[model samples]
Target: MFWDLLVLVFYFIIVFYFGFHFAKTNQKEEDFYLAKKEIHWFFLLLSLVATETSSLTFLSIPSLSFKGDYRFLEIALGYLIGRTIVALYLLPSYFSGNTISVYEYVGNRFGKSPQKTLSLVFTVSRLLGDGIRLYVSSLPIAFLLERMGLNLSPEILGMIALTILSIVTIIYSVVGGFRAIVFTDVLQWFIYIFGGIFALGLLVDKLDISIWEGIKNLQTSQKLNLFVFDYLPSGDNSYFILFALIGGAFISIGSHGTDLMLVQRVIATKNLASGQKILIGSGIVVLVQFILFLCIGSLLYLFYSGQTMAPDKVFSQFIVAEVPSPLLGILVAAILASAMSTLSSTINSLSLTWARDWGMDRWFSPRTLSLFFGLTLFISSLVPYFLIQTWEKGILEMGLTIFSYTLGPSIAVFFLAKGKAELPVSGLVFSVFFLTSILSTVAIGLGFQISFTLLIPIGFGIQIFLVQISRLAFKKN
Candidate 1:
């Protein structure tokens, strides 16, 4: 326990020291939020990976692999393909103007109301979705530590972890801004990826199986198959394959293309070409990272088949139970680093969105912006206190599902904005309000899942038809 605390303290010190070091001198809003838009490609690529990957993958991907096999790669492929499309079409437009918030592009292309509405949606979705995500990501560690006589309450343990993470992340984000976040994220990515690979090698040794044999076993178990139509839910119906493909694509666009957290790296780039490169380079990095983690997950399940009670804990438990104390310390550091890297990105992104889109700079005085930021973070953190849960998912699918809501409304906003067609503000509001209500209620309450094919068509159909009707009515008059 003493050793774990020592390592955790040292790791956090490095983060705070760097954050304060960067922000020690004069501080400005642009420097604080956008890092003065002077980031390099390599660092931006790393930040992109860190922002998108999150700490959840560290624990969850291996758990998924333990349950099945390479089937998870299908989701990775979807994101890779989807991001490539975004790199070509969407990124250039974001660069076209010195846009601060990506959703602002939606407003410029659409109108004020749509932009503001989507910004609000992004904030709500991320805090609820990613807040729960952050909570769940730390649960595996808390569970394993408790079992080892570290004996902390899960809620208490989670809070302690979140507090450390928030402080370390906030220091750099609030001070050094995007540049600090990206540079640190690049450093942390290597720690996370390398630590995961090391754990994977250790797991394979314990399994008494070569990695190739494990692959063969997983293939024979049908965990390797990407297309699973065996049990179709009502919404997916007969079009399961098509649904998987389309839904994956839409979810990816909503996440990588529209979400501000993911786009911050692009916005920080020196030029449009650099931004495009960051998107493509980061997309490839994510693909490789997903494969590495998924393979580790497979190895984890194979080794610990009957020994562990919960499969979710297999990956982190191996680090806690089997790895030597010093190495264990390093693993914990890596996990916290991963978590802090992502949380910092989230806070900075949320702050930027609020400050810019909400007109905080103009509407509020300097003192008010400071107060608003603190208040917003305080309110956002309250989410995990009430709603964190322990459900598990594969790294890719888990991210996309959380991403759907964040991306969905923004997609509608951007599509309208880029189309530059006059959309009825009333109709736009009604369409977003209705779609959000139905999707949230059905998906959460009734447990109904609609495939992307149906959801996208319906969501866009309503918005477009309303706009067209308004146009015709005006002409007729």
Candidate 2:
């Protein structure tokens, strides 16, 4: 136990070393976020990959394959399409202004009222989505603590886990700023990817099955099924190929094109060409990443001999029971790497969004910006304590589903801001925003039968449709 923890401590030590070492001192807001400095495109590509990938990708992708198949890649396919579209359209707006918050582009195009409105919606959605991610990362940590004979309730374990993860993430983020976040991001990305490969190799040695034999077994069990060609929404978050492709595309566009945390890295690149490269490249990188982790899930299913368990629990239990010490600590560190990279990004992004969008920067220094959001994030991370078990979906799905509510409307508005037509804004902004929120409430909260994948596309469509109608209404009047 001691040796395992030591490995984790050493990893964090390196993270801190790089964080403060590269962190800009006497920094203004531009230096703190993504202004004035030139980061290489490769680092920007990896930073984009690391920030959005989160614990949900690390743990949930494998869990998806363990229970189902490679159908999740259908979403990846949509991601590629979505990103290509963003590179073509939305990114021009991102670069057109010296926009601090990406929403500033909206303020430039529409009005400040519209800008702050969308930013507020993003904050609520981001906190809730990232809160679930914090919970997912804690699953393994809670499992590890239990293995070490910590006789605590799951909620208490969650709190302990949240505290440990948030503190380390907050300090470097607050002290080092975005530069530190990106540098550590490159490091964390390598660590977690190695961790995935390590687990895959371990499974290979243990299974002791021929590649041909394993492939045959996978075929027989339908575990290699990659496409779901259904026509209608299954109402259960099931991915029909079309639903997956379309919904995934919209989700990617909304997330990568509109969300500040994901898009900022792309915008910080050296030029428009570099921005497009990283944005599109990240989608491809993430698709490959999904394949790697999903394959791990397949191997795990074989290792466990097809026993049914909760998707989230399957991998966590395996890490606790089978993984040896020091190695065990390293694996835990890998999970922390995924979780912390994102939490750090969240605190910084939240700080940027709040300070820039809502006029908070006038009253708050850059460090104070990080400090406030970091504390808010720490408290938010514990929200899933008792409620986690009540979730019907895996952590990854839940995280995406929650964000789709607002992400859909957000991307829709971005395009609306870009269009040639002048739309009526007096009530249109709140109209689409509240309508999407209420629809999400009714669908998921009341257990309606819409594919979670379709939430973004559906919401985006609804908002765009309404804005057009409002535009026509003004012309008629």
Candidate 3:
């Protein structure tokens, strides 16, 4: 336990050093938000992957595979397809513009009101979604402390872990700016990957099974099954392959193309070509990373002989009960790395949107705004502590569902701007209301059933239909 704590302390020290090391370089808004557009494609690729996938990927994805099958990979394939579309259609507009905020394109195309409105949507959605991620990241740490015989409530333990995570992440993000976040993300990407590989190795060794034997075991149990061609409207694991593919593609486009959290990294690249490489390459990397963790879960399921456990708790439980000392600390650090990477990116992007899109720069420096949003997000992270206990779905699914509510309207607005459609504030409000209602189970209350996968495209279609009606009305008037 002592050695494990020592390793954890050492890891924290290294991360802090990097943060302070880059603190000297942040002299302007660009440096603070976009890394001065100086980031390399390789580092940006790593940062992109690390930022988009939070602790949800690190901790929850394995649990997802353990409880279910690898059919989720179909969504990843959809991600690749979606990113390819963004690379071809979206990157050209983002690259053509010189502004740091991607929503600046919205303002240039439409008006200031929509830009600010969309920025608010991004901020609120990220706060809710990544806030849950920050909380989820601390779960394993809380569990680790409990296993070490700490007598505390889960609430207290979660608070302790979250406070540490927020303080450490905010200090670097505020001081070192975007450069620090990206560089640390590069290091963290490798650490968590190594941790996943190490955990799989330990699981195989302890199970006294060869890799080939484990594969056979998984195959015989049908845990290796990766595709479901049937269409089901609602059931456990009721994902239809066709809907999954289309939904996955639209979600990816919305997330990577429209969200500033990712587009910021893309535009920071050296050129259009580099941006394209980073965007598409990150999708591919995400696919491989998902496969790796899912394999780990499969191996773990074989090791445990399919004993039922809470899906989210399975991987963390293994780490605490089964992993040896120093390596346990390393794995914990890896989890922290994943959580911090995403949080730091969220805070930075949120601050950037505040300063650039919302015009907060008129009142405060970007640095001050960065710190402010960091603290705001820290508070928001606590919200999930109350909500998570009652959640019935896997953490990964819950996070995805929360974000899906906003993705459709957000992406639809982008298409509106791109088409030069003139939409009023009421039009935007109606779009949000319509999308949120239909995409949610609330639509069932209205006697309609909408699959989650179809939400984004449907929302996008709705926006287009409304815009056309509004245009025709203006013409008649």
Candidate 4:
């Protein structure tokens, strides 16, 4: 335990030092937010992958496997189909606009009222979503290590881990900006992928299960089904596979192609070609990463010999159960690396959006930005009750649920080009209210899987219908 903690402490120190060291080079808004448009496509690609794979997914994937099999891959299939659509359609829009905040383009197309409204919604939703993700990643380590005779409650341990992460992230984000986040993500990406491979090797060798045998075991257990047609009986609208294909494509196009966190990387590119390349390469890399984690999840079932383990905690459990203590420590560091890479990327982007879109520059100075960034992260780390529920229930459902609820209204404002709609301020304010209410009701009440994937197209329908109706009525007068 002492040795393990020692290695982790050293790792934290190294990350902190590196993060601060890079900050010395950041000086302007472009430097702080977009890495001054100097980031290499390769680094941006890794950062994109890192940002997309949250700690929630890291822990949730194995838990998902334990539930039935590869039903979780349904989500990945959706993501892949979604990314291809995004690369072709959404990528060109971002490349042509060349904006800092993706929301700005929406504003440019429609108006400011809609732009700020949508940006605020995204920031709020992402903070909640990523906050849950951070807690999910940190909690297992806290729990597992505490059982091994460590001294800390799960929450405190969770917070401490988050604090360490925030400090390292702040150091780079405050100083070096986007470049630092992307470059560090390059290093983290290697560690996480290598660590995932190492964990797989440990499971296969330690459990006496060859890769083929592991697959065969899962196949026999009926955990390998990738398609499901069952839904509430008598319900004719039960088309999850279709939703996964169609809804997922639009959701991906909107979130990855239009969301600020992602577009910031693409816009940071030296040129439009490199920007497109980063999206394409990152899409491929993310798909491979998901496959690797999914395989690890399947292998974990064999490692445990069918004994019931906490599904969400199962991935970390395999590390603690199968790997030797020393290597387990390394893997733990790698897991933390996975989580930190994401947390850091988010903090950096959040700061950029807050400063640029919200006009933090008009209200406050740089020192205030640093303090506000830290405060926002601290506040965000506290909202993980959803993590407990998601863990107890299932990962895929929780993620899809979130996407379904938030994506519709966000997409409505964007594709309809309603950013600058005439405002007594009511139009912008009402749009935010409309989207949030619908998303909340759908998420909490309707409870359909992949709701946003289905609803986004519907949102477009709603937008166009409203526009035509309003125009016709005006002409009638």
Candidate 5:
């Protein structure tokens, strides 16, 4: 335990160093928010992956494969397809002018009202979705401390964990700005990826199983199954391959193309080519990372045959109970690294959106606004620790599902703007209401049980259809 604490402390010191080091370079608002458009493709690529992957990816994804199969890879493939389309269609527009926030494009195409409205939506959605992510990130820490004989309740431990994460993230993000976030993200990405690979190797060694033998066993058990061609509207989240593919594509579009958190990183790159590389390259890295963790989960199943646990808790439990001391600490730090990477990005992005879109920067410095949003996210992160017990789904799915509620309307608004149409504020409101209403009525009120996978595409279609109808109605008037 002492050794583990030491390693964790060392990691944070390095993160703080980078944060302050980068802060020395901040000369203006653009430098602070966009890194002065000086980030290279490689670092931006890694930052994109790190930003997209929270502790959910680090901990929950392995649990997913441990409890189920590898069918989620289909979604990763869909991510690749979606990213390609974004590179071809979306990246050019973001780079076409001196755009700071991607919502600036909306203002140019629609109006200031829509741009600010969309920014507000992005801020709210990010708060809710990443709040769940922050909670999920605390689980491993809570489990670890509990195993070390801490006498606290899970809720107490979770809150403590979240507080620590928030403080570290806020300090760096406020001081270091975007450059600090991106560069540190690159470092965190390597640490967690190495941790995943090391854990798998350790598991394989402990089980006395050869790689091929484990693969053979997993294959025989159908645990390694990668594709599902069925279309059951009410089936499990992993079974509907077609919907998963389409849904994955739409989610990627909403997340990578429309979300300011991600688009900020893309536009920070030197040129259109660099931005394209960041988008497409991140998809590939994410796919590979997902496969690596899924394989680790499969190996874990072989190691713990006949044991039953909650899918989300399985990986963390193994780390606490099974792994040896210092290595255990390293893995825990890796989890912290993953969580902090996403949290820092969220804080920075939320601050940028608030300042840039709402004109808050004129009243307050960007650093001050960053601290403000960081605190807001920290408070929001605590909400989930109390509420997550009532949720029936895994953290990853729940977080993604929450984003679906707003991402569809967001993407539709962007697409509408691309067509140079003036979208009314009422039309934007109606789009969100209509899509969310249909989603709830069909899936909850009527109990037809549509898969969460289909929500984004369905929502996007609804928004587009509504916008077209509004356009036609305006023409007739």
Candidate 6:
């Protein structure tokens, strides 16, 4: 216990050091958000992966394959194609000018109303999405706390984990800004990947069965199935294929393409070519990473045959049960750090977007900006804590559902590239898009049979359609 606590404390010390270390580099406002140092494509690649994945991934992916098959690989395929499209098409548009955030492009294309509106939308939506992600990502660390025999209820443990993540993230993010976020992202990516691989190796060693026997287990259980493009019956247009590929692509287009948090990273590269490399490259890295985690899940199913466990609980309990103390500290640190990586990214990006795009930097220092957004981030994250039970599909789907909400309209806003719409008109278009998205998500939550994935296209289509119609309706007026 002493060694684990020591290592965890020691690891956080390094994290704080990074925050302070980068604090020196941020002399200017832009430096705080978009560092003056040149970042390599490789750094951005790793950061993209780290920013995109979180503790929920560590907890839920294996659980995904443990209970079901690897149809997620189908979604992974869409993610890959989506990134490629973003790299080739969307990124070029974002890189044409030195915009700090994508909403600048929105402002330039539409007007201040659209720009400020989208930035506010990004902040609000990310408040929900990243807030949920931060909460779920805390689960594994909270599970570790439970194993340590803390005399606490589950709710208290959850808050402890969330506070640990948020504070650590805020410490570095508020001090060092985006540079620290990117560098820590790279470091945390290595840490968590090693933790994951170690878990897989440990599991493989624990299983006494031969390769053939393992194959037999997978075959007998029918867990190896992938690529199910199941369409809903009775002319249900919201099919898995539709959701998995088309919906996946649109979500990716919106997320990687339009969302300022990630797009901030993409355009941070040295050149257009470098930006393209990292954007497309991250998709491959993530696909392989998903296969690794899903394999861990399938392996866990074989290890605990005939045992019933909640999908999200599979990896956490295994770690508490299987991993020894010395390495336990490192893995625990890794899990918490993975969550911190994303949380920190959210904090920095949100603050920078607020400071620059919303013109808050005019009055606030970078540190002040980070602090304001970081505190708001922690507050927003708390909103989902009590709502966790309602998301029955567990953390992974909940996180994705949150992404689908504002992301679709955000993409739809980006697609308004050709003409200048009036501020009121743009606002109305955005309102309609977001309204449709909110209604669709609520209907799904109320047990509507439609796929939640359609929220992306619905938002995208609604905004684009309404804007086009307005353009036509007012063409001669």
TM-score of each: 0.85, 0.93, 0.93, 0.86, 0.93, 0.91
Off by over 4 Å in 4: 144-148, 228-239, 365-367, 383-400, 418-464
For all candidates, the clash counts are 3, 1, 0, 11, 0, 0
What digit string (tens of lDDT, one per residue) describes model 2 on residues 1-477?
A: 888878988997988887688565536898888745488988989988999888777877899999888999999999999999999998987887787789888877777777787787778777778877787787787777777788888778778878888878888898888888898999999999999999988888889787789889988999999888756533454488877888889889988999989888888876788999998999999999999999999988888884777886677777788889989998899899998989888888888988888888899987898888888877766765645555525544555666767777777788878887665756446445546653654475436656678677767776777777767877899
- Over the full model, what C-alpha lDDT does candidate 2 score relative to the true structure? 0.81
Looking at model 4, residue 69 earns an lDDT score of 67
Assess candidate 5 and give its lDDT.
0.82
lDDT of 3 by residue, 1-477 (tens): 777878778878888988899988888888888877888899999999999878878887888679888988988989999999999888888888788999899888766766887787788778878877887888877877777789999899989988988898999888889999999999889988899899988887898778898788888878888888876546633257887888899999999999999888899988999999998999999999999999888877887784877777788889988988888999998998889999999989999999999889889987898899899988877876665655624544555575566677677777666664456446356445445533543343224446677767766676666666666877888
lDDT at residue 108 of model 3 (Cα atoms): 81
Give lDDT tens digits, candidate 6, residues 70-179: 88887778888888888887777877777887788877776676677777767877776777777777776677778778999988898888888788889999888888
lDDT of 5 at 78: 89
Tens-digit lDDT track of model 4 for 246-288: 6656666667765777777777887877877877777678767
lDDT of 4: 0.67
Worst 10 residues of 1 by lDDT: 388-397
Q: Which clashing pairs does model 1 show?
A: 62-297, 109-417, 110-417
* Candidate numbers sorted by lDDT from highest down: 5, 3, 2, 6, 4, 1
Per-residue CA lDDT of candidate 1, range 13-48, in tens? 777667667764326667766677776788888888
- Residue 87, model 3, lDDT: 92
For candidate 2, the 10 contiguous residues with the lowest summed lDDT are 387-396
Q: After best superposition, candidate 2 residue 241: deviation in angstroms?
A: 1.9
Q: Worst ten-residue run, lDDT, model 3?
A: 437-446
Candidate 5: stretches off by over 4 Å = 233-238, 385-400, 421-447
